[model samples]
Target chain A: MNWVWLHKWGSPKWFYALSGRYLPWLTITSVVLLTVGIVWGLFFAPPDYQQGNSFRIIYIHVPAAILAQSIYVMLAVAGAVGLIWKIKLADIALRQAAPIGVWMTVIALMTGSIWGKPTWGAYWVWDARLTSMLILLFLYLGVIALGQAITNRDNSARACAVLSLVGVVNIPIIKYSVEWWNTLHQSASFSFTQKPAMPTQMWFPLLLTVIGFYCYFGAMLFMRMRLEVLQRENGSQWSTTEIDRLIGEHK
Target chain B: MLFRQPSELVNPLAFFTLVGSLFPLALGTQPDFLRASAPGLLWVSALLAVLLSLEGLFRSDFDDGSLEQWIVSPNSLAILSLAKVSANWICTGLSLVVLAPVLALMLGLPGYCLPALMLSLLLGTPILSLIGAIGAALTVGLRRGGVLLALLILPLYVPVLILGCGAVEASLQGLPITAHILWLACLTVLAITLTPFAIGASLSISVTE
Candidate 1:
């Protein structure tokens, strides 16, 4: 019955301090997992019988793609929270998360294209998944562009929130329609879902990378949110004291 | 109001026709090639024409201060926003639908695909106007919102574009297009019911800022 913990998230000072404590641990976990996962997948896991060494790209491709989509959903949810509850931190989260989402989408698209050259025999094709991911990239760009175009911080956050909410509603419809259109064209040379299951060795590292990517995202988001909080709360007692202490410690 | 300002209707129709005609010239005048590409070409042109018309959807009102008046009025902003978008669809989308068959024929589309082309546009264009109105509302307060509006709105137009062109393409190949039509209808209905609230909310943000 205790909602007090939830309310604490509304306070930027509390979130910044709490996230500061957790950031080092999150960074350490993500760095370890990513290093282990990449090394294991690259060196130990068996190559695809069909794709050969090119299959290793899946370690990067799949996690980035997953994070890209997850970030969009998170952005939308955070936007909704800001809209409904007027939480400034949620607004910051929504704004700060977009550039990271854009990078994830770019990584996914680039790696997918690189992987495609060896596997699908072309760097690009109008495949359903590829097209939808491309659209997702545009959706993120739209959020970032909207945020930048409006000068007022509060207004920009609200506008971006509405845009992201509408986009989240449309993402499924866009994906389904793209898939249906692909079926009509009948040009799907390789389907990700139809691939046979991977061996335990291949997939275990993938699982690690996926979790690492999520932790990495959390650490990055918290870091960005803290910076934004400090900037927005500049000259406030807590931020001033924190900055003075950091300066004092440096001496 | 649209009739009084005939260019509002004429401009998008002209844009649609001009873009449709450019394809055959650029792609060569081969009838078969034109026919094959006509559905996508016409659909994309129509989409762009609707987008072009959307830039002005709230600009004049916002500048004239009527948009702020609508916010302060007793009537619901959602209904008023819906009415504005509907008027926009009538001026832009409806005109494109009615004008599409002429362009389709010119592009060498067979007689059989004509009905499906018109029907798909009839169902699809309203969704374009409704959704684009949200973008228009969001940017109505900006000085140079034209390019940003297109960037924001075009990605969202993908599904409607796919379904619209898919329906016509199916009919071109003598396949059953009922599924595409039904999906287009579903999108239209969903847009009709949902986008008004988004438009209303976005307009308030734009205006209040």
Candidate 2:
């Protein structure tokens, strides 16, 4: 049992230390990758034979879309772990993930709409993929709302976790929506399971951006989680010293 | 103070469930757009039913002091919240599933699509319950929470509505309904697995506040 406690998954103190160390690397890597990917994608990749310059939006759109789903799953996993183990850190992670996930969803929607105007000849369609993505945005909003609505930190964390877990359904809907129904949105051009839909140059920078965005996500999540941990643990002995030190440093 | 007598609500749900199913029938042969919009209309009304039923989910327990007992019970607050949400769904969402075919007919949904419609509703309504529970749990003790609940819940309802309507529409168009059902069923499974945990957490939080 002591050994198991050594590996305790829910320990806030351990997570705080670990995330503090990890934040710098995530920030640096995300910045480098995003810069390289964006530049290479915008300038180097060949324009689409069909959509011309407008196809460039895929660089932003795909990564954001993928991140949106990934973060939701992360939120669900954190929520589940929090519930099952009564882990305080997991709840913090769950809350930290929501706003980032929501931002990713918003970016995806905006880029999709921007991409849509040129490619699909309209800004909006009742298309399954578009609609499902919109719903994905809503799910994120619900989780965020639930988080804010709750007053108690721990209870809010738990509620938010549940919202994340339940809302996981929207992830698959967003993923397969383009395929399940005949719609205005095109099928995925990039996949590991099947041949890449676009040429190498296009997929390469996009992949880089995806990796960069992930690092960025990690950095942001850790930063937020750190702040949440500090807020929630304020009156605790460890945080009291930390908070005093932070305050002194700020002065 | 706000609640009707316990006896009052005992059969109100059943009575309202019947009235709920009768609403579309009363609107017969009127607006062409509404008739054409059958799938959306029934879906909206069904959503409204879920919303209406949600008001009583935590309210009654809250009003009667049972909620305080549940909070302090040996059972975890999360578990109690899950039980309440599932019970609420059984009373409300299950009723929608049972009433779907009749309502489908009234909404002028095609005869052939009735089976598919009912099946989708069976799978989908639970999700509505689960998702709606998040909103209900959040606003459980808030005053005049209907609009807030609507704002919080309506957006979440879109995917279920889309897939539900999609399945029936597919059946009407004679396309393969399997894929649509598969998607909605997938959604249901996801909701079943995830929502209770969420609503439970939300319920606890609301109570604490």
Candidate 3:
């Protein structure tokens, strides 16, 4: 029932220091978890019966794809918070997440394509999931583009928030439409979700990687949010004091 | 005042025809290829034309200080923005619909598919303008918002493009097009009902700044 933390979250100084404390733990956890998961999936997990060892690419591809969607949802939620509560930190978080989301989308698409060539016999196919992922990438880039294009900082944040909110609404429609279009075309590419029942060996490492990736996202988001807070709040009392502390430490 | 103008409609319709004509030159001169590609080609061209016209949707108003007035006016900005978008639909979107037959002819699109093609545009073009106005409003204040406008709006336009072209293609195959047309209508309704609020928000930001 305590809502003080919601308003507490609006304070840049509180968020900055809190996330600074969180950063190291998040970094170490993500790094360790990622290394263990990747190594386990690569070496310990059994090879797929159909895909051979090539199926291992799913370790990276699936995690990136998962992060890709999660980041967009995060954007929409952050944008809504910023829009409704006028939380400056929420706007900063929303903006910082765009490029990270785009990179996740790109990684997902690249790994998907690389995996596709060996398994699906083509470099690209307008399959539903991959096509929707591509659209998600465009949605990310659109937010980034809108942010950079506008001159006024506050205006840009609000504008990007609006666009991303609209994008979030359309994301499902685009996904479903792409899915329907793929079926109508009867695209030659096979659907990846027809996934066979894995004997736990495959999906267990996947579960680890997914967790690791989420931790990585948390780490990256806060780091970016911290830097954004510093840059945007440069002349303010807290940022200036923080700057002085940094400079003093450099000596 | 814009309603009185003829040239406003001329350029986009010209661009629509030009884009439609260029496909045959690039793809092949064969009527068969042109006909087959017509549905997709026309839909894409209309989408582009709507995008091109969107650059000016709020630009002139923003530059002239009228957008700011709309934001501060007693009337609902969303309703006013919807009026502007409807005007935009008539100028850019409907122009493409009227020119659909001529562009289809250039693409060697069959007469039998014309009703489906034009009807699809009738249902789809307003969605283009309505949705595109969001991008136009978002980017209106920027020096080079045109390309960014395309980047932001085109992804949203994908469903419209697919549904509109699919309707025509379905008709070409002697399949029922009710589903595609229904989807297009749904999108147009969604766009009409919702995009004005977004455009209002975006315009308020741009004009206030």
Candidate 4:
């Protein structure tokens, strides 16, 4: 099968139309999956058998942690594509992803700290995983700050992309931190491909939450991409009509 | 790749490394428990070793328009960058590898653990050079960015330091250090495969402005 459509992906107009078609479905899917995850995690799934009620935070914490990392990779890939192809939409994609990544990192840290309180007996420690996550947050913030600092659009995108790619080094550090150090945090007990250490009642909801978070990330990215397209394309005659039509429909 | 080869005899990294390693050696420490911290001392010294060598990687080229010339050259930048980092690994990283036994011995590293220390440094130093390339590439053109460069890279260096030290510590305890070696190898392979593209990309971006 000729997968030529993937190469045509650099076009903003095409991506905008495609994402518009997919956004509503993603929104619905995210809401449904998230609702199921929280309900199942909180009520149906057995508590940690060890940590009791506080164990429920895993539903939020795990998903946020996963999203925080996955989003950065996506951002870097988008940034790479922008750099390679000089695609304006790829730059837009990169820009849209930064705030989402930073926020996801924030949520991961917050929920992880909250989970730590009951499980680890403290809100924070200089644990490898926790500290690296903090550093990842700063890396995201650095990209956003650098992006904003550069007034030139192309320079800003390139700079942010470079920063994100360099920051990709932290992913490994985060992954192996526990193994490398005597940290309070335990090693990863679950793997997506392997049978989770937890029962299906717990694991299934986590899977759902992960899927939901992915959808939510997509929806947020699409919304931001659309806004960016409108702003960037405002000066063009074709975009003027398209944006006006969009605005008129909203009115 | 061919274009990045400099005809000049200048090599600033050599002098930098020679002077840097002596800084800690000069500090007079009492015959106390602090001196007993062999793993910690070696790591601190190694960290300084990596940092000192990193200064001239990108800065010197950046100063003379050679960086911009390399960025726009017909050669594949990734390959060129890989060559440069390989040179760095050879020069400074090998220096660390060869210096490890001597330094470890001075830091009171047990004779039995020297093999593990050397093995860890052998596997770990290239990864440091590779990761350090990204930081050097990022701040290559910036003025007085050494501090920012350290801040950006040191946190990411945590895993390497942890694993590098852990391997030696485990060997000192007579525990199985195989897993640590495997992980360090994995990190090295990952860095070797990925960092060239990253450094090349970052170098171009940094020089563009």
Candidate 5:
């Protein structure tokens, strides 16, 4: 396959222009998808026979949980690319993704806990998924903290890359161990999976919401990457000219 | 070679002893409580002792500019990194394994579980050193990386900690400790196979910065 497109995306100037064009589409589509999915999930989807309305939280919980895990995967994959190619844009993507991943993990935990309150009769049970997510949050915090602690930007990015990659290697092990530890302590919950044993009405909106979350992440990622490109390339001729063009358009 | 001298070994060993001894006083001399908690207590203490000494893992080398020298050496950095990790395990990890039973005994750990505790420590501590060395390498260039290093690595340490203490706990409960021990062994093997490259890469970034 011809590789011009790959190298073009790797370049900050091209990426900045392409992402700017996509940003408006990303923002409008994600916002619409999220609103429609949430509305469908909350009002139209049938409630659980056992859980009643509290199970509605799955709309938010599963998407955030999936996003949280996938974001970590993205961080590691991007970091590996950055390290291998010495791609500044990939490094920026890696650095930019950490805090968002942490927040998504936080949302998952919060919603999981709240849902637990009504369903499990307690807010927390040290459940396997929750515990695993907690550890992931810590891992994200570690990446973010390492970045902040180091003074040099390039060093910090590479360091964070190496650190997150290490964390990525351990991610599966952590999930497995936490899950094993959980089973040792308690019986398993009815986890939501792609082929979950639920009615179509119950699971359909969840599918929509999951897709919506991916769109949301894509939108946010491109927006942040654009800002990162401008900041890192502030003095470059292309970025300066682009900034002037934007200023002229606004004026 | 910095840790070859007896004095260098003594510092962490002494600190290890002091940490292990203080637990009984802080928690009181209740034998049942001590026995029940001994595995976790000793494991946590060992984990901390290893972490405490990790500061020295690359600090001296970085300060004296030897880290850069190693970075530019003709040989593979991953192997060199593994060599340092092996040295660290021998000095800190092996010492902790040796000291664990004494601490176990001090904590009134049951007689039957001593072998289990030793085996757990033997399998677990090396994984700690291997992974911990990655954090140490990442932070070696920073002026204040001690606590930051801990924050970065402790979450990753959870699996090994669980398995190590779980082995002893299983043995004490008259259950099969074999599975837990096996898990620890597998993790150590995985760490051995992979962590050196990670440490070497991080160290290259650190020293080159």
Candidate 6:
């Protein structure tokens, strides 16, 4: 089997070049989508009959929550790739993705609490989704803590990889068990397999924001990965030449 | 082998009992309140005690270099780590299970709940030991890993805590507890089959570093 394609993706230099070329486009797309989606969601979307304007928080809360969970899966997959292939880029991806996941989780929890106050008459409840999301926040903190505790870079990355993999396996079990433990909140409002109960006006911008959040995540990851790649590859000929060329262009 | 150091076995059991006693004192010995809160209180205490003991699970061997030798041996690291974790379960987890009845009585737990408590602890503590071993192995090389270990392992312990407490709660309400026990057993089996390799891999990383 041809291994060149695999090697190309694995190479830090190739990733650096490719990500650089597309970084501006990703940034522009994400900024535009996020702006348009948030503006439309906030102003144009009709208010809920029951909830009125409080439900506007769903646009941010839903996207952040979705991104929080999906980013974890991405972290685990990247970690697995690094472990199996020993790819430097995969390790960078795993590390860079974690802080972003943490922020997303925090945003989800904060917005959820804000949304909860007006809707549920309290800022917090032992609802299953809230509890699970809190646990996800802890899980993210654990990954970040473990990565920092170890002094060795490669060892830390691999250790976090094993941990995220274990966490991914446990995610389903945790979700179900927490659901069983208590479920005071309403059932899910959005699902891929089922048609949403709300009209398109309410959900369309939500869809846009979800996609926008993903693009934003990609842009963030690529930005962080590029900086990390340059840091790790410092003093190497290609990196030095790249730096010199950029400096020359700036001058 | 763990029995040689009696403190290793005794400390966690003592911690469990001490933690169990504090609840009644703080909550004012009201039997109804105690009875209602007994299941959750007992499980949380047991979980903390198990986490406390896990800090030392591999510390001695890791310090003395036996962990390195075991890794390099012809025998599989997974099996070797499994043996180590099993010894830990017997010393700390089993002792907690056996000692829980006295604590249950202190907390005014009903007689019918005792069997369910014992059964749940029996099935659930092993899962704690197995999963905690992975955290212990991961942090074996760090100088200050105790708090970090708890942070890493506690979130993973949520399902066990929920199921174990749920089993006892079910018995309290005269509900069928077979489902909770069955789920706990399934979690134990999954942990047994999967965590040993994680423990092995984590140990290799810690030892090599």
Docking class of 3: high
**By the lDDT metric, which is better: model 1 or model 5?**
1
> Candidate 2 lDDT, tens digit per residue, B11-112?
434554465456556666664544456666666667777777776678877777787787688987667776776766766677677776776676567688
Candidate 3, which segments miss by more than 4 Å at Cα? Answer: A183-196
TM per candidate, chain B: 0.98, 0.82, 0.97, 0.83, 0.96, 0.99
Per-candidate Cα RMSD to the true structure, in Å, reads 2.5, 5.1, 2.7, 5.4, 2.2, 1.3
Compare candidates 5 and 6 on TM-score and give the better one: 6
lDDT of 5 by residue, A81-142 (tens): 98888999999999888888999999999998898887787888877777888999999999
By DockQ, the best candidate is 6
Clashing pairs in 4: none
The TM-score of the first chain in every model comes to 0.94, 0.90, 0.92, 0.94, 0.93, 0.96
Determine which window of 10 residues in candidate 1 chain B has minimal summed lDDT.
Answer: B1-10
Candidate ranking under TM-score, highest first, comes to 6, 1, 3, 5, 2, 4
Model 5 lDDT per residue over B33-82, tens place: 98899888888988998888787799988999988889889988899989
Model 4 lDDT, residue B97, Cα: 72
lDDT of 1 by residue, B7-53 (tens): 98899899999998998878999888888999999999999999999
Q: Candidate 6 lDDT, tens digit per residue, B17-126?
A: 99999888888887888899999999999999999999999999999999989988999999999998998898888889899999998888888889999999999999
Off by over 4 Å in 4: A1-9, A39-48, A83-86, A125-152, A155-174, A177-208, A242-251, B1-36, B71-119, B174-194
Better of 1 and 4 by DockQ: 1
Clashes per candidate, residues 3 or more apart or on different chains = 0, 3, 0, 0, 0, 0
- DockQ metric for all predictions: 0.90, 0.36, 0.90, 0.31, 0.82, 0.94
The fraction of reference A/B contacts recovered in model 6 reads: 0.90
DockQ score for candidate 1: 0.90
For each prediction in turn, the share of the native Cα contacts (below 8 Å between chains A and B) that it retains comes to 0.86, 0.38, 0.93, 0.40, 0.76, 0.90
Tell me which of candidates 3 and 5 scores higher on lDDT: 5
lDDT leaderboard ranking? 6, 1, 5, 3, 4, 2
Write the number of the candidate with greater DockQ, choosing between 4 and 6.
6
lDDT tens digits, residue span A203-241, model 1: 889888988999999999999999899999999999999
Best by TM-score: 6
Across B1-209, the per-residue lDDT of candidate 3 in tens digits comes to 45666777677888888888888888988888778888998888888888887888888788888987897799988899999988878777777888899888777877889999989999998988888888888888888888899999999988988899899999998999999998899888888899989988888888877
lDDT by residue (A21-126, candidate 6, tens digit) is 8889888988989999999999999999999999999999999999999999998999999999898898899999999999999999999899999899999999
lDDT of each: 0.92, 0.76, 0.87, 0.78, 0.88, 0.94
Q: Tell the DockQ for candidate 5.
A: 0.82
Which residue segments of model 6 deviate by more than 4 Å? A1-6, A247-251
